[model samples]
Target: MAFTQQEIKTGFKAIFSNFGFVLLWLGQLTSQLADRIFVYVLMIVVYQSTHSNLGVSLPLLAFGIPSVLVAPWAGVLVDRFNRKGILITADIIRGLLILLIVPIISKSLLWIFLVSLLIYTAAQFFAPAETSSIPELVEKHNLIIANSLFMITWMASSIFGLGLGAPIVNFFAEKKTLAISAFLYFVSAGAIFLIPLKPQEPAKKKTHVLKDFLMGFEFVRRNQVVRYALLKLFVAASAIAALSLLAISYASQILGIGEKNFGYLIIVVGAGMLLGMLTLEKLRHYFKMSSMVIMSFLLSGAVLIGLAHTGDLRVALFLIFLLGVGNIYITSTIQTILQRKIPRPIRGRVFGVQNMLVNSAFTLPVLFFGFLADLGGILFSISILGWLVLLTGFAGIFLPKFRTV
Candidate 1:
């Protein structure tokens, strides 16, 4: 049903009417913010101690690899078990695992890496469960705003977490800062506990768990539109991974700003995304979702190349802001399309496959680009990466299957 003007007038008020979804947003936001803080801490610590560009990139690989390996198993659990229980349990596991870092990190860096792997694995389970739970918490008509709000939580939290991460680390240092990171996970669990949600049972099945696990992968491949959405998201995700790996170096080496100043870049991007999302909601009905996706992909590619080439901080900031604007359109729309198109029975697995595709896309590129930046310098490495994104955008136009998006 098309939204009434009153429904539009309600805007956020309509979303807030669904209290369960609000709790879910709260849980996801804190957990995501905690994730950023953890990354920032690792970034600062590794950069300071080892002073290696690749060293700063290593934590990203550690974060993404676990999610890739465990995503299928996690998706199966999300579909088979109670998602609320899975979310809560994952939070507890990650919270406790992060605390262990405070002790062992002083002894060895291996411990820090290991803890990051374990905590991310726990999050892998939480990710699909949360994505799959959206239909249960909010009505179908509200999915766009619901997904947009979720994306906002993502950028907004990162803005604050990354913006504050350096100062917080400089203030409390690593050990105490990690202690606080653990506490945020507890807060997430508490918020999730307050969410009065029940898991939806898929159509009755006597199928084997392995068969069920494999089905999510097969499901995505069979659907043309969903597959196209995933391919585009994968491309965008890879570019983001490359950007994240290079941001510190981009600031420090190319722009002649200090490394810590990267946070300002993140904050600007977040602000741009916030504006993009707001614009999207207002104009959602003005364009077809498929057309919008294609346009945004092309837009992202153009600006990413711009950001890569610019050395002036002011120009770089504008380009990153435009990237942020384009990114929200792709993310929010792709997620909303996935939610609307995928059947709830298999939503967990679809999202599981999605998590694997994006992060797997995220993992290898971050490492490759880090090595590339070291060898070729940040300017050449990023310029190549941006052109790659632009190429992906071109692919969407020529590929007839993408026309179906």
Candidate 2:
């Protein structure tokens, strides 16, 4: 099952040399960077205006709600139409929506929420189309490297996007930052335009959307690998979402730094993710996918527990850094598994379901933990999350289906 060094070397070389993949990667880089900054900016604005963790969570809820409602239909469309068109159109619409936010920035939170809702609704279509496109653009054997490269840039953008958010807002002001994010979305659309993807053939027989969506769920139910991978993905997604909400409180209350400086902690987490991705790239041949995932769960839980008690800035940074490493390992491994295991024709539908689950994962954690942090304090809530993660990892060891992964 181990890949040869020559095979690995060739895979990496082939990824960069493939023009379609390069364009896709570039599109992903810009779009994801814009997304991170957009969310950070929204959180900052909402937090400052209302000064409540619950206020901050409201916008996050807006972001997640669309994924629940739109992703399934978006996935069906992806299978039935040209994905490149969907991707390009989504970018344009999202860009426009972001621009629309500028005029009403000073008006009302409800307007901002409405704009946020529309922006993420467009994003729902973009996400599955973008993921499914990777397999089409790259050779089957090179998928490992392709996904690795994508995950690497994903974190790199997070590092720069979140790291730059405070200064970007302070210097350019919120309106200008929104303008810059809109511009990046347009740049992403332009990159996708240059990619030479063949048109997806229409389904020979028109299928009902509800039927197709159900079929996707059926497939996941029957396929143990996909089911298990998705469960792991959900856990990882929830952990990250909850952490993002709590990081503001952790920075202000625990570390005694101002809430505006929360991005510094995120920057540290992103650095750790980048380091983890590089290490995973180097050592992938040495570990089983299941082993990597289980280990990551345990590592993430331990880090969270450590972070829960620490008040020293350096120690908290180090622990959160490890949390980032564990998060990346879980995500990257599960994503590669899904790409390899799912059938090509049904990839869009399944990934759409995945988007739903991941976003739904965001909804509960953000709301519950936002309230929990306010009531029980940040450390207590974080400790509860840490224990939950730890127990999940321990349970995985005895689950026959998971062990088989």
Best by lDDT: 2
lDDT tens digits, residue span 40-131, model 1: 87776776666666777778888889878998788886777888999999998988998988787667677788888888889888987887
The CA lDDT at 47 in model 1 is: 69
Candidate 2, which segments miss by more than 4 Å at Cα? 1-9, 139-144, 281-287, 398-402
Q: Provide the lowest-lDDT 10-residue window in model 1.
A: 1-10
lDDT of every predicted structure (CA atoms): 0.81, 0.85
Residue 304 lDDT in model 2? 93
For model 2 the local lDDT of residue 271 reads 84
Instruction: Report the C-alpha lDDT of model 2 over 107-215, residue by residue, as the tens digit.
Output: 7889999889999999988877887789889988888678767767876896779877877887898889999999999999999999999987777898787899898
> Candidate 1: deviation at residue 277, Å?
0.9
Residue pairs with backbone overlap in model 1? none
**Model 1 misplaced regions, further than 4 Å:** 8-21, 132-147, 198-204, 282-287
